[model samples]
Target: MPENDRLRNIRKETLSSAWYTLYRYDFEYRRSDGRWESRQREVYDRGNGAAVLLYDASRRKVLLTRQFRMPTFVNHNPDGLLTEVCAGLLDGADPEAAIRKEILEETGYRVEQLEKILEAYSSPGAVTEILHYYLAAYHPGQKEAEGGGVPEETEDIELLEFGFEEILEKVRNGEIRDAKTLILIQYAALFGPLRPVAREIQ
Candidate 1:
């Protein structure tokens, strides 16, 4: 049976809409034993987003960003600062187009060609955000502006560049803790552009 067929009495209530949206879902779920149980879950709909790893194969370097994340700060991050790949909410745009714009807005690199890696949900149990992942090659000549994110959005992003091996070391030492960043780095190590160098170091 389809998953939807196992659910009934579905209803949603908006809990908050100030930022994105928080919805409470009440429904009856059919269990494996054929019993129906009432359940409620709060889901956050912050809209889908995209992320990209900008690398220069010749130089063996990758471009990343540093910014303050309030959620991380409140949880346990020492200073709320996190190093992450360039990313942003899609805001109703296509994944590729959105990521390309984000790359320019956050890194100042206008890359013409992007290789999409995969798409995954950020936090399926609570957040309704499917993040598209991409990889793009970039060089200094592509810099068009001093990208620090949009001023009106209060986004103060700092661009950081690190050698491929240096970044992998950071990942091992627990310095790079962002999930999306980790995913892209691991992908590069296993099968993407950085595979050659990554394998050499291993």
Candidate 2:
């Protein structure tokens, strides 16, 4: 089918472009019954991003980061401190390269072997962001510097490493609330290096 076969009168207006772009889209939509309806929706475009879950299979540990998020703070998150995998906006860079840089900047690990696992929209309803997810192995030798996020970006991140079981407990207790982090951890438990531990927990 043609991309716009079902509708017409599509138009968009830029609502804001201060930090990122926010667009208001007005279009006609074809319902299932073949009736056309006019609709309007707002979309926030902050560019695409990439994230990586750094793990140590030999020691059964995973590295994560803790940082404050203003959005979460205003949305009833008590402290707004989120525990998540190392992630960053692609900023026009390749997904793999972007994730590699993020791993170094947020966790101080110079990882070379990254396995791309998933690509997903951060929030499909209102945001235009596709997050590229990856998994990589890390060891003590890969720690080249103290990774606490870039000061220029006003990022104050704390590195956290936990045994596989301990991290799973955090997940069960709601300590790990970040969506990307939760998804990656669940993926690891189901099909990645943490499979054995997950099975044991069951």
lDDT of 2 by residue, 53-127 (tens): 899999999999999998999999989998899999999999998988888888888986999999999999999
Q: Please give the lDDT score at residue 118 for candidate 1.
A: 95
User: TM-score for each prediction?
Assistant: 0.97, 0.97
The candidate scoring highest on lDDT is 1
Error of 1 at 142 (Å): 0.3
Location of the lowest summed lDDT over 10 successive residues in candidate 2: 1-10
Question: RMSD (Cα, Å) of candidate 1?
Answer: 1.7
**Model 1: per-residue Cα lDDT over 29-125, one tens digit each:** 9999999999999999999999999999989899999999999999999899999999999999999999989888888889979999899999999
TM for candidate 1 is 0.97
Clashing pairs in 1: none
